[model samples]
Target: MKVEWKGVMPAVTTKFNEDDTLDLIMFAKNIRAQIDAGVHGIVLGGSLGEASTLLAEEKNVLIRETVQLSEGKIPVVMTIAEQATKVAIAAASDAHENGADALMILPPMRYKSTDIETVQYFKDIASSTDLPIMIYNNPVDYKIEVTVDMFEELLELDNITAVKESTRDIINIGRLRNRFGERLSILTGVDPLALESLFMGADGWVAGLVCAFPEETVAIYELAKAGRPKEATEIYRWFLPLLELDISPQLVQNIKLAEVATGIGTETVRKPRLNLSGDERKRVLKVIEEGLKTRPILPDYKSF
Candidate 1:
C-alpha cells in the first residue's frame, strides 16, 4: 500500500466511552463515512484525535482497527508526536507493526529544538522505520517550523514524502513547490484555508472538520480539483462557519459536538477537557445548526 500523499486524509477524532475507554463502535462508524465519501486516507492519533491523552497501546489499537476498517481501500496513517527522539522512533515502529500504512510526525514536543536538532529528529525517526512520513510543519501550534531550507536537508530521506502544511502562510505552499517541485507532496492542515491551499497547488488536505462533514469536505476537494472553483467556493463559504471550529483550541470537543449533531459521534472527552457548556456550547451549536440548515445540495463531484 503505497501512500499517494494526496487527497483528503482526515485527522479523525478518537471516540471515547463515558468511562474514557476507546469506543470502537463510534470510531468505525465515522471512518466508514469517510471511506464512503471517497476520502484518500485516514490519519489516527493526531491533535484532533487527542494524541497526548492516548496511551501507546491505545494508539496501536487505533492503527490496527483503522487498518481493518479501511480494509485496504485507503491508507491508515498514525501520528507520531512524542517528545523524546527515542520514544518517537519506538512509536513509529509500533505504528508500522500495528499495520499503519504511513505516519504524520510532529517536531519535538514541548521542547523547541534548534534547526539542526529538528532536522536530525525527523531524520532519526524516518531512518528508524521503513514507513513513509508526512511531516506536520505547524509552527503556529508546535512552535517549531520545518523551514524550506531545513526541508532541503530532510529531502535526503526518501521516506519523508509529504507535509501537513499548517503554517497558515498561503505563500509557503508556493515556496515549497518552488523548492521541491514534485519530490515532496503538500497537504493543507488548516480547515479554514483548505480550498485556498488546494487552488494554490497543494496536493491534498489533512482535514479536521472533515471528521464530521466528510461528504462536504470531499466534495470541496473534488470540485476544486475538477476546475469547478465556483461550485467549490459555494460549499466552502457555507462550510466556513463550521470549519472555523477546527482552528480553535477546543477543536477536539468542537468537532465531537459536530459529530453528535451530524449523528456520527458523541461528545465524550477525556479529563482536563470537558464538553462545551453555557454560551460557548450555544454559540458553537448555532454555527452547526446554521450550516446544516443551509447545507447545499452538492453537485456530482465524481462525475467531473
Candidate 2:
C-alpha cells in the first residue's frame, strides 16, 4: 500500500504486559481502534511508542504486528531512533523485512552530530532501504535540528520523502513549505501546534495524543484540511488540555494513562519509567477525565 504521508498518523504507544512483555493482543486492539477512528497511517516505536527503551527484537514485533493488524487498511511505519549510522541502517532493513510500509527516522541520539554528520546519517539510512522515510525533526526533544539548508542538502535522497515538523517554531513550517514545496510531505509533529501547522499548509499530523482520542484527532485534521477551521478550532479549544499532555517530558506515561482511562490500552511502562502517581497522577487523570466527561461530538470524518 502506498502511504500518502498525509492525515492523522498517531505516534502510537507500545502496549506492554505487567511483566514488561509486548502485549500483542491489546496492541492490536489499539491499532484497530485507530484504524476505525479513520487515522491515515500508524507509526510504531516512536518516542511516544518508547522506542528508546525497546529491544530491536521487540521493535520487530511491533512492526510486524502493526502490519498484520492494519492489514492494508493503513500504512504501518516504524521509527528508527538509533544513535549509530550502522544500527539505523540495520533497523531500516529489519523494518522492511518485517513488512513496515515506511519509516520515521530521527537524527542520531546521545551524541549530537554536526550538520554535515546529521545529513550523512540520514543519507546512509535512506540508501539502505527502499521504504519511504519521514524525517523526524523534533529538535526540541532530540537536540539535533535538521535546518532548512540541511534539508536542501538532503533533497538529493529520493526516499527521504517526508518531514515530521516538530521544531515548535511555527515559522519553520512556512520556511519548509517555501523551500521544499511538494518535494517533502510536511507532517506536523507537535500536537498543540496541529491546527496552526495544518492551517499554515502542513500536509498532515504525526500526532501524539491521537493514541487516546483518535476520533477527535482525526476530526480536527479532517475539519482543518477541509477548510472548516472555525469548526476545527472549536474542537481544538476543547481538546487543548489533553493535547498539552503530549508535550510533557512524561508524555508516554501521560498518554498511556489516558489510554487506560479511555479503555483502549494499559498504562504499564517498562522500568526506569513509572506510571503517573501522587499529585502528577491525579493531575493528569483529572484532565483526561474532564475531557472525557465533556468529550466533544466529533464530526464524521470521511476516510480515503
Candidate 3:
C-alpha cells in the first residue's frame, strides 16, 4: 500500500445521508468503481471530499474504511487541510495510526503564511509523521503558492516526496521536473489540465472529476502514457466540459451531482454547501446528461 505518487489518484468526494451522517455504503461503492476502473490510489478528505466540514475522528473512520475496501490493492491517502500546524500534524499522525498510506496536505488554511512560514509548516508536519506526503500547491485557489524556491527548501525532508500541482501554470510541471528530477513526484491536481500536464511530464493526476468518470479519466492518462495522443485527444476533447466542473467554487456540489448522474453516489452535502439548484442545477445536469449520451466507447488503452 505504498503510495507511488503516479497514475490517476482520485481526490474523491465524501458521501452523506439525508441526516448529514457519513454514508459509508455509498462511499465504498464509488471507491470500488475507481479501483475497478484502474486508479492507482484514492485520496480521502480532500477539497472535493469536503475536508473543511469533516471532524478529526471522522477522517480516521474514512481512512480505516477505505483501507479495508482497497484491501491493499492500492494506496489510501488522507488529505490534511487545517489552519493550525498543530492540528495538521495531529491529523497526519492520526492518519498514520488509522492505516493511511500517505497524506496530501495544504498550506496553512485561511491565513496566508509567508514562504518561510509555509515551508516550515510543511516541514513540521512531515517531521511529525513517517508517512510520505504530497504537498497540495494551489496558489490560484488556496492563496499560498508553494513556489519552486520554496519546494527546494521543503524537499530536504525525505518524506516530502511529491506535490499536487494545481497552480494552473502548466510550465510549473516542467520546472519541477527539471529541478527535482526523480527526487519528487509531480501529480497534476487540475482536471482540465490533466492531459496537458501528463504530456508536460507529470507523473500522475490527483483528479476531481474522476469521482464519477473514473474510466474516461484513466483512459486519458494511459493513452497519453502509451503515446497514443490521437486516441487520447478524442476523449479529452469530449471530456473538457465535464472536467471544467472541477475548477469552480461549488466543485463539491457540482461533482456530487455528476456522481448521482452516473448512478454511483448521492447529492447530499454538508451545510454552508447545498446541492446545485435553479439554472445552476439545470446547466450542470445538461452537461452531465450530454456527456453520458455521448460517452465514448473507450479503446483498448488498458492493453497498451
lDDT of 3 by residue, 158-189 (tens): 99999999999999999999999999999999
* Stretches of candidate 3 exceeding 4 Å from the true structure: none
Q: Residue by residue across 74-144, what tens digits does model 2's lDDT show?
A: 89998888878998889889999999999999999899999999999999999888889999898888799
Candidate 1 wrong stretches, greater than 4 Å: none
> Global CA lDDT of candidate 1, please?
0.93
Report the number of the highest-TM-score candidate: 1
Question: Each prediction's TM-score against the native?
Answer: 0.99, 0.98, 0.98
**lDDT for each candidate structure:** 0.93, 0.90, 0.92
Best by lDDT: 1
Steric clashes per prediction: 0, 0, 0
The C-alpha RMSD in Å for every predicted model, in order, reads: 0.7, 1.2, 0.9
Clash pairs, candidate 3, are none
Worst 10 residues of 1 by lDDT: 46-55
| Residue 67 error, candidate 1, Å | 0.4
Compare candidates 1 and 2 on TM-score and give the better one. Answer: 1
The 10-residue segment with the lowest total lDDT in model 2: 295-304
